[model samples]
Target: MIPIGMIDALPFGNSRRVRNANKFTELKASIAIRGVIQSVLLRPAADRFEIIAGYGRWLACLELGLTEIPALIKPLSDEEALEHQMEENLNREDLNIIDECKAVQQLSAFYNGDRQAIADRLAWTMKKVNERIEILKCCDEVLEAVTNGTITVGHAMILAPFSTKLQQGTLSKILTEKWTVSYLRERASKGQQNLALAKFDTAACNTCPHNSAAQSGLFGLEDQKAACSQPNCFKEKTASWLEIRKAELTEQYGTVLLIQQIDESDRNTVDSLVVGEEQFSVGCQACEKRVVLIDDRLGRALGSTYENQCIDNLCFSKCVSALTSPTPIIENEELLVAALENELGNTTPTISTETAPLKAKKAKTEVSCVVPKKVIETNKAMLRQTSVDLLMPQECFQLAMTYAALKRLTSNYKSINKELSNPNRFEDTFKAALRLNVSDLKAEIQNITLHLASIESDQTINITNMMIDNITFAADAKAVAVAKWIPTKEILSEYTIGSLSALCIKAGVDKAMDSKKEGGFSTASSAGKGKFVDAILAAEFDWSGFAPDEYIALIK
Candidate 1:
């Protein structure tokens, strides 16, 4: 046991095999409760001690604020320390297969790259050591699947003999279709003696030592060479030869192309294709890889567009890669110029200074696009009005509705324009636009009604009623808010009898009734609504006293 200073002298590769980060907390707690039960292993160094196997215990000691840790000191070289650490970590039952393989690799390095020596040192058979080593050579997917228990180590061994592409396909099928080991073995065996490979040199394959059919010393004493096997070699060579031919065809045609299968029903015309009875136009212009044909013999012999069909009738891999990778998006001239000053400062030497005058001239030309004086005045008149533009949008919208309703009540409302002393063109525009706005409002209301019908809830009625009240409130608020001088008499004709009664009552209707005889009340009622409305508007009135329902009723 010796004193420990800082916990930095040792590398953590051998000590880092842990299932969870909670183990650190648990180790720390254990040290706090009972102190380090096992001493941290240390190797002698120039300045301090290098940790061998007890890194967690050291960390726990450091966390407990203990300056010294109980450590077994050993005078050993780097390889000897690493070997000791690997042996210590590998003995732990909690080590996963990945960490186990890594420990084995480290231990093997200690034996001067001799797996047999490592096997002898650990008392593990050479075959078992090699089997675990081969696990590392398998693809990451296979490793993950094996670790997850989706596929067994035996399945990985069988798949290890195939090409990476085939291995990936088999893994995908195993995951998607839940393939059994026997099913995978059968599928793999069938491909080894396929009809495609049978045509090529049978005599050569029968006697060939590389062929799996030969069955002698298939397992080499050294590392296995999966690519040198019969089935894989034949397929790879054939693919390479065809790839060369495909490249030649591309060179002859002088353009990239994409080949797609067309349904037999739609094969009469060269202009289009069909996929399962659904016709799609494949015009030369629509083709993504329509090469520019030089007007030569081959160009004339075949049309301008050539389908990317290979001699073996397979879609090219490069075409799929091209489809997956989109073309770089380019910014337009307008966008470039707009952001040019921010993007390219005066210090930037990329864009030439000589072109500055031309750019400035173009900018001036764009800025000088003439707008007519009439249009400028009209726009100013539309937007600059303080009286109308200052009103809340909701209030203005309601006023528009009121005006539209009034215009419908009065067929010749346009002729009866009693302009205010201080004229408002907005009110005049509202009167002019009344008909159009009414149509839009009706369509909007219809859509709202349809939408409301689809929703069934306890709040539906409340929501609908609230919407109605809001629209009515905005319109009524704007309608009675008189500015400058209003033509109250002209507006009276659009008002209903209920509105007339409300207005008259608001204007001291009881007082008017007292002055006139009670017998004349019947006369006033019988005189028709036109004269009564005129009389009511001519009379001095306070409309503010009326309820909102009564006030808005005039517009309705």
Candidate 2:
């Protein structure tokens, strides 16, 4: 091995030339800053040195303007040098994929007679070597893409299953359209047969109400949930036709008829008028129950429009009016007489001389109206009876009375001038009267107080157990003190006494020792302090020492 002057261009082989010039530039920058971390391997030839490995470094050194470089000089046969060169280039991180594929292919050819021998020498699977050989069969475009780093070998492998023309088409699509390899694979898996087929027509989508609603942004999957829970549930569309009908009626009619009004007599009539299949129906057996109904058939029809589909009662009523009205007939005789003279040429030609002119048959009546008073009265009675039945139970009523009395007394006290009123005197008198006259209320209050006390005692026990488990005697005394002071409420459920002690041990209590570092006296600070005080009381009563790490962990 010797350090020699750098050669302008080392002749290894024309086939093994650099593909990416930027890679050499990066190497030059790295060499300038940190010098060469590795030395090039070379073999002595008949007249000069031949590079066995480290072509990238050789180029980088050339770019860096280094006149000479350190080299590992090794004597080897042509076959051995070539094998070492392939291994070295294969190991380089920045080796271009095309160059690697080419090198692997040549190595396999050179060592054809020795398959296992080559595999062991290269430290690669026979299967992998075979796959690299197959990669060489890919068309020039695909190979060029692989060389330029536009597509990965994995992507190439997916494309490998397709015909060369198909691969080229897919590659072109990917490059032009920026399709991801996964998306390509997904499309391919769907089969190439469908790729040429026309996509579904947008106009065809108008046939589906859901598609229309989605396009218009009027309804979505979220609104669908609300529709399901509504009184009218329709399958083909999300919104109930009943809701649309109500909105329509509200907009068009001066007033919408009460559900009771429709249910009592004309719900069937309205359903027959609204042009759709009935989805939901409700009827009240007593006092004319108001019922909400949906027509799913109409919903499907209007939903297809992708816009407002309101068709209210008012519109239906108008249609009914048009159908029932009679055409006008003229009753004036002057016009009739003129038309008769004009047609008959002033003829009063034939006068009927029968005994007495028969009177024209009387016209039949064409309109009728009806009203029901008994039904209205019955409905009012039912409503009043239901209201009375909903009163509170006897015990709840008694409790309410006691609460009212207490509230009244409190209100009267509040109204008094504080400067003139003796609150202590008022409280004492009130307490005495409450105890004497409200014995049951007093007992209830005592029970509540006892229950709260029990809960507090249990919480205190839990906090004491945590401090004992977390604190260690070897920790800093101040940190121990701080850990003890941390409130039980502040500790997360996962932080047992042992864990808190470990945390205090990690965090020294130097801050706790400084008076200036104490948190301020705001409501939040007070609550925190209260928690710390509770923890401290628990620790002190249990004779637990603080672990600095445990305390610090808690703080963090």
Candidate 3:
């Protein structure tokens, strides 16, 4: 026990307070009631003692106007004192991950980059130590985002697996748009963590911290653990794994097989070597899943469902044979689902009171590794036996595209189309256009748990022609076009308000909120318009076309 006056802070003191410094009011109250619970470490200075730790206690004593505080006198060098201060603060205070990371790094450097020494001194597990240091390895954008309040440690950890450019863009969208952590998490994990669900890699997914399974405690909440939190990284890894497998298979088979971006388009789609190799045409079974095609949104994405693919059982059996187990590097969705159910395990999340059931449960079927191809096949066969008009997801997706395409091609629109301006009219017209009487589209979607996956570049060009040949539109196609366009205003109001605000900021627009009342982006907002400004700009999702005035008119 000693008087507080006996121990001097430092010759320069630590400015008494730093920015974002934690308040000591609670500590002050505690000491005022119970006195100092632990003694601050002190070392002999020139005339008095210097505090090596317990700055909070020193502050508390000062706040309580106490003449003395408990002190443990020790002998330490300046560097040793700093180390003690850092370690003590880290263990005591719930420091942010970035600060904790920096402190860990300083300790490592102070000990000549000795991992074991740092771990031993800090009394931390090597795993924990290594993980903390890993945070410091993130790109500057991610680190800065963490340092500021832009992102949580969990977000940074997930982003650590992606490209630097992607991290920068994702962080920008997150911060500028004020997205919820849940939304960011869901968006980040949108696809099968970049590995197609059809060819999901269970073993890699199970062990990766980027996998929600490996990140159980990362978010400090059970439900908050997102699945495949780094889709970009997952996609890259899956692609590399596929390439390595392809090479090995090529070496074994003594010829080339499936090539081109994962969507199987003709850009690099047709192999000259395969021209003479018609006898060895292995399969285009997973062709759509294995190629990348450019989208109308000017982005590279996967292809769509292939129904004209008329193979049914024959193709299915062939796929099974080619993808049988113990075969060198062949992955299929059902097998991945089997691994998920048996190996990693899938627990349906308990519904949370905080989140809306619509949003929370929208993802229920999505995160599951269960493959629906067999189930859908069974449904199709049953439907074929009954009436074939019961529309499945594949059928519905094609219908939606055909409707959009037909509308685009249709020219004549005048007063008769005015009645179709209502948003509900589009839904009705879309169903009417589908021409399915017995099937309820919404129910079918829910039952099948269908995602369109991708629009497939070929569909965009040929859908109108295909639809014209098969079914006829009820009203003037222009009215249907107007109906499809009607939903545009609803999407603009509901989804794109924040997105527009974000785009405006990226375009260097001034005070985006000034136009928020009407939910419109003004030309005066910035000089950057029409042109995509950011590397990963999302103008399509944000609602482009129709200037501020014209768009407001349309909405009205």
Candidate 4:
């Protein structure tokens, strides 16, 4: 037995950060009734002893005010100490998976990332080592949640492959919505696109661990069926392949039509072009209307395409009408010519080359000076205010509106208001020695009062005009302010998928996403927009001049 005071815990001794309160209480009770039954493992350390195992038992003994603990003191290296600590923690019924991950990570580092060696040392299967190490990819919040028993290790594993911010957001949803492990498992499995239908090369996916075929060894699968675990990667490669195919089609056929870009009513397939008695047109191959199409099947077939379709149904209908219509002929050419000239004279006059440029320039000048009826009405209303004696009331209103708009538009308004709360004050020590006569002073005061009312009237006019116009210079200025606006998942959730995709594409977020990972581009483009937003927030990227048109339209 060694004195409890003389024994110290090694750094890796406490594997669990959060312990079950009931379990700890029961342990203390067990020790109090039976005293120390099992001897703790320890090693000699500079006149004292360092605990190799049984740190929890040592803690229970100390809390009970016990002076001595039964222990077997032996000299062990750091590796042996860590192994013993892990063994003791693993034996406990209430060990947190996060603590297990931390212990495994330490052991991994000890062997310099030799997975096989670490697995052998811990007497665990290679698959188990791979699974535990993958759990480390989860964000801090997820790991903490697992440690706190808010979520199971299965949930953590499902969320581990995604980005950190996504993991955090998904964890919150899992708890609040009480998402079942089965639902997550189903979602994880069903979200994958079939490898057999993929337009891209399947060579790389054959060896990828994210591929179902590559996981047969780890998962102990009887069959080596192929499927993709990383939907983003699959989507990205498929999109790239589709683009390459589009480029080739564009070279062969002058025009390539995207089926999604055409309206349902305007699109026609080659098979549909064959009328009851009419045969399929062979000339279509060489005609100008010979267009190749790529169809996405309304997002059902995300990275797949359908070839050889026409978007111009109206043109085909016109050709058919021309072929079926009867022709009319005119016998008197001079009479027809005279009739045409008279009609042209009454409706559309021909302008000489020299006069055309002058007419166009005059028309442009007239158009530029013609103010919108809305702006004119606002100006006229402000002009009717006779009480205010100020020049250019409209310009003054514009200046005041601009300043007010800038403050509200920019997020710095609150900080600027804080600065205004405390202003430097100075006393006017020197007063004017000469005072104006009573009549002059009264005239001056009246003039000042009139100017103040003019400013007030300008403000009132601006407020009314803003509602009528619904658009102003302020909206464009707001775009500049919005450039500095950082987007959160909540903020992004307010936008539709189409709107978010538009904003991300315009901002070159797809390219940025691709730069980070191999299949990131297509995955972010087609999958949830939240991943793009999360990546932007994580990198603290300077998305300068990035403003959603809808956001600007709100003010307009």
Local accuracy of candidate 1 as per-residue lDDT tens digits, 274-329: 21111111112122222221111111121123442221111122223333443533
Per-residue lDDT for 58-167 in model 2, tens only? 76776677766778888986557767777777777776776766776555434322346657777889887656655654556888898888988767766653446677
lDDT string for model 3 (1-556, tens) is: 7677777775323312222444566677778899998988889887788887888788778767898878888888665677667767676445666666666655543443456787898788988777776565466788878778678877776665444556678888878898777787787677434333413356656676666565555558564343566656755655565565544332222222221111111122322132212211212311221222211110122222122121122223333343332133314444444444544545543333235222111111111011123222332232232222222334554554444334433332211233222313333434444554324444433322332332322223432223332322333432222223322232322212223333244333423333443323343223232221321132223323312222222221
lDDT (Cα, tens digit) per residue for candidate 4, span 134-220: 787677798888877888989988886555555777788899999988888777555655577676789888878788876666656
Judge candidate 3 at residue 60 and give its lDDT: 74
Off by over 4 Å in 3: 1-6, 10-23, 63-65, 138-150, 161-168, 176-556
Of 2 and 4, the candidate ranking higher by TM-score: 4
lDDT (0-100) at residue 426 of candidate 1? 33
Which residues of candidate 1, in runs, are more than 4 Å off? 1-4, 9-12, 15-19, 22-25, 62-66, 192-556
Name every residue pair that clashes in candidate 4: 470-556
Number of the top-ranking candidate, with lDDT as the measure: 4
Candidates by TM-score, descending order: 4, 1, 2, 3
Looking at candidate 1, the ten consecutive residues that score lowest on lDDT are 361-370
Question: Candidate 1, after superposition: displacement of residue 483 in Å?
Answer: 99
